[model samples]
Every structure is written in C-alpha cells, then in structure tokens.
Target: MTTAKDLLIIAIEVDPSGPVGQGDLSLALAGAELIDLLGTRAVTLTGDRVLPAGDAVPEDRLLAEAVASLDREAPYETVDDWLWRRGRDLFAAYTAVLEEDGQLTRERRRRMSFAAPRTTVAESAARRRALHRWAADEPVILALAAAVGIESEQTEEEAVVTNDAVTTVLAAVHDAVMELEAVRRRRSFENAAFANVWRGA
Candidate 1:
C-alpha cells in the first residue's frame, strides 16, 4: 500500500550563477508546493478527495505547510536521507510523465540524459541539460501533479483552482530568480571593489 510516507517531496529552482542565500529556501518552498499539489491531485484522482483545498495559501506558504505536514506525518531516520530519497523518486516520475506526454522533446531528452547501461556521456550531458531547463522553466508543480496521475478535468472549479495554483507557484519562482540575480550582481560588485582597492606592490 502506497501511503503518504511513500510519496516524496522535491524543491525546484532557477539556478543562480553563484549561490544565493535564499536560493535553497526558494527551492525548498517550490518542492513543498509540488508535494502539496501532487498529494491533492492524487487523492482526487483516486476518489479519495479528503485532503483540504490548498487555495488559501500563497504558493510559498502552501509549500511550507506541506513540508511541515509531511514532516509530522512521515517517519524517517534522518531529514537529509528522507529528502534525498524523495527527490530522486519525484524527479524520475516527473521526467517519465513529461516524456510520455510529449512535453519533453528529443533535444531536451538528450540534455537530461544520464549514464545508464545504454546511454553515452553525451546523452547524460543532454539529460542533465534538459532537467536544468525544466527546472528553470518552473513546471515542476504541474508536472509532479501529473506524474502522480492528474488528467484533463471537466469541472470549472478544478480547472480554476489548478490554474491559480500553477500561476502562484510560477510567480514565486520568478521572484526567486530575480532575487538570486540581484545577489549575484551585488557579490560581483563587492568583489570588483575589493580587487580595485587592494593593489599588490
């Protein structure tokens, strides 16, 4: 029986050239949103629509709550171990669904390839690139929900809620990217200033 414990959470984010302090937090929030969306979709699709509507919270807050809820409900030996395992599973499921639905292309597939028995290094590089692009695109929320088995909906309410959730999450991602860019620029300016002031004799 696949319980909530079997489900995994993985945060996705836009990559900053240099690390930003908030990058991890943003990604963690994104992952939580994906988990929440997926959990909701899973229950609904399974005819077990008991989970609460996630319409009230902003995307980041929703994600935070989801993570907290998962922590309270799931038993794991260590937090890091739990996160790593969950990330791997979610990534695999997300990639597979994208491929099946034609949302993932051959070029993207090449970019997101990995070193498996039949794949070359070039393929692995391509796979990595594809995954990076997808991460940058910020489709993890919808993709993860689809992976857990959400299909085309007939109800206006479901459609509206899902669309709103996706939009909210994407907006949060854009803000995170901009924030990261600002941090990178600040670091660059400071580095240049320090270098210019210290002339080695």
Candidate 2:
C-alpha cells in the first residue's frame, strides 16, 4: 500500500482522544505522498522545491495523479505550496478511494444511541500492513502521524528520521498544521468577541 493510503488508514483506525482536524490530516497526507514519491525517485527536493525526476507513473492511482500534477517549470513548487494545494480536501478524496476499494466499512457507533453510523477502516490486509508499520516505529509514517496530534510509540528525537527529503516534507507538514491551528484560534477569538458585542457584554 502507498504511504498516503497507510496514513489515512491509521488516522481512521487509531483511537485518538479527539478527532483529527481534516485540514491537518489532509496536509499530512499530501506530505506522505511526497515522501512516497521521494522513495520511488519519482521526484526529488532541491532544498524545499519539488523537481520531477522522470516520467515514471506511480502504481497507485492517486499517486499517479500526484505525479501528473507536479510543476515542471522553473522555480518549481515549494514543499509548503504543494502541501496546501494538493492537500485541499485530500482526506476526503482518500476516504472516497478507500471506500470504493472496500478498505472502509461502516459500523454503529455504540456509545451514542442517536449518533449516525460511521465508516471505519475494515479488517483487511492494507490495514494490517499499516498497523504493522505503525508498530515498527517507521519514522516517516510516525512523523506524519505526530504532525496531526497522533502520539507515536517513539518520540521525534528517538525516531531519528535520516532522509533529508522526508525530514523536509515532515517539517513542512508541522508548520502548516501549526499555521492552520493559529488561524482556527484567531477565528474562534474573533467570533467570541463578536458574540459578546451582540449580547452587549
């Protein structure tokens, strides 16, 4: 399975204290795709900029589309730029693909009697592979998971991710997630103040 798919499965199957932000998850998924591309030598990073290495198509359909979307011009897309652009609604896209591929199944959320059923990652080979990778403390996948607030078996310093390109993408993902959180906080404060004014506080 592709890194993107594996990451998505982990996000769904793991029981975090709270739901992962769709935006943060999407950005990480985009970063995962870039890391996978680097693994295949389909693309490489010159500093933070993405440069296509060849015309080779990726085996996964989503990854193949990612290759097609690369910027081939001078001053190629920065890793940060690619994250936000390609990551737009990326979680939803991956969800659709997994569902269509039968990697996702639905079950009743037992705790909430009024709650609608939710789609959960199925018991499949893809899921087992992802969980095994998670258990093995794979640095790239763990780093991506951590960026979205999922705790890993090993801390960042202990994991010791060696590849510079993967490190670059993971750093970009962390920064983007931070920026998105800051925006959320700012909006929340603004709305709170607006509510106070409306209530003549």
Give me the candidate number with maximum TM-score: 2
lDDT of 2 by residue, 1-201 (tens): 899999989988885335698899999999999999999999999999999999999889999999999999989999999999999999999989999999997677778488767878888999999999999998888888899988876877887788888889999999999999999999999999999999995
The TM-scores, one per candidate, come to 0.33, 0.94
Off by over 4 Å in 2: 109-114
Give the C-alpha lDDT of model 1. Answer: 0.37
Residue 102, candidate 1: alpha-carbon lDDT:
42
What are the RMSD figures for all models against the true structure?
A: 13.2, 1.8
Q: Give model 2's TM-score versus the native structure.
A: 0.94
User: Model-by-model lDDT, in order?
Assistant: 0.37, 0.91
In the range 69-115, model 1's lDDT, one tens digit per residue, is 43322232232332333344343444344445443333334455673
For model 1, what is the error of residue 92's alpha carbon versus the real structure, in angstroms, after optimal superposition? 15
Deviation in Å, model 2, residue 48 alpha carbon? 0.6
